[model samples]
Target: VHHGNGTEEILGSDSRFLFISSHTRGQAFYPGTGAESWKNVLNVPLSLGFSADDFLREWSEAGVPGRIAAFQPQLIILSAGFDAHRDDPALGGRLETEDFLRLTEHMVSLAWGIESCHGRLLSVLEGGYDTSVPTPHRQRGGALQRSVEAHLKGLVSSSRLPSNFTSSVLGKRKKPQCGSIASV
Candidate 1:
């Protein structure tokens, strides 16, 4: 919902840590400090309620990929914020659960290309406010849960054989089984 102003403040100037953030800016967004890129911090601000295609385009065409490749850091950490989900009311980000999986897959592939980041990836759950109360029948969880599962699936997809794609991801994936899911 907000920008990583603290992270940028501490490590933004450090050449060892390259921070690339795609967040909503130039509007009534929170913090209001990441409107421009500086030093190691590459801020790609977009309009409020940005679509999935627009977000992906910023990574694909907006020089993010190029910058990441040029840096070639030893480790890659995804501050996996699910507030961007369409169902999330916090940040007007419109992205499906599948989109998170696809993005994770792409990131994993990108990491694979970097010899320093040879699968040394850490996905830390950051922001997600799917505050909608679920009904009795809809006890199967909300978009945040789905997004986390998709992200986890993406993380594990690389190790799984290509032939077991469909069967491997079947059945219910609980939060505790993967990691702790802090509820808002």
Candidate 2:
């Protein structure tokens, strides 16, 4: 899969933004820059056939979640890329749809943990394969759609989740109430 090479490059020198990238590793993959972590950048490069458990472990054992907590960023920006999905033709990053939901739940809690964030999180649509044709709504594979739905479902159920998960990803301005998908 194509890694966040450009974003990392753009923000590499800027300490104001911490660059944490997780991607499939090795030369066979595209844009192999994030093979190592140094300075303000934390690269959680994964080997081929990385399973759901391995993918989730990046936030823990790989030291990403702690780093984010220590940093306590004011604004949390997420590049929601679902290309690692098993259904995707990308590299062997085998994360299922439910994994995205679980990750999003944790991310929502993590973002709210930063007192300054105040549920202000931005999730940009980054990557998801299967758009073989330019059809209506870019109808990605079920994994991407379900993963996104699962991700949004986590956001919607945020109020019930831990750490005051009133994330702005709920698509609201007048309090973090659940809204329609169009808002997202």
Winning candidate number (lDDT): 1
Q: Each candidate: what lDDT?
A: 0.74, 0.72
lDDT of 1 at 53: 85
- Model 1 agreement with the true structure over 1-184: per-residue lDDT tens digits: 4677888888887888999777777656677667778768888887788877888887677688778878888899888888888888775688888889888888877776676666567989987787444688777567888888788877766443233334443435422232332332
Give one digit per residue, the lDDT tens place, for model 2 in 1-184: 4568889889989988888887787765787667877778888877776776887776578788778877768888888888878877774578888888787777787776766665456788787874454358865546667667777876755364444223443444434445565476
- In model 2, state the lDDT of residue 88: 76
Q: Which ten-residue region of model 2 has the weakest summed lDDT?
A: 164-173
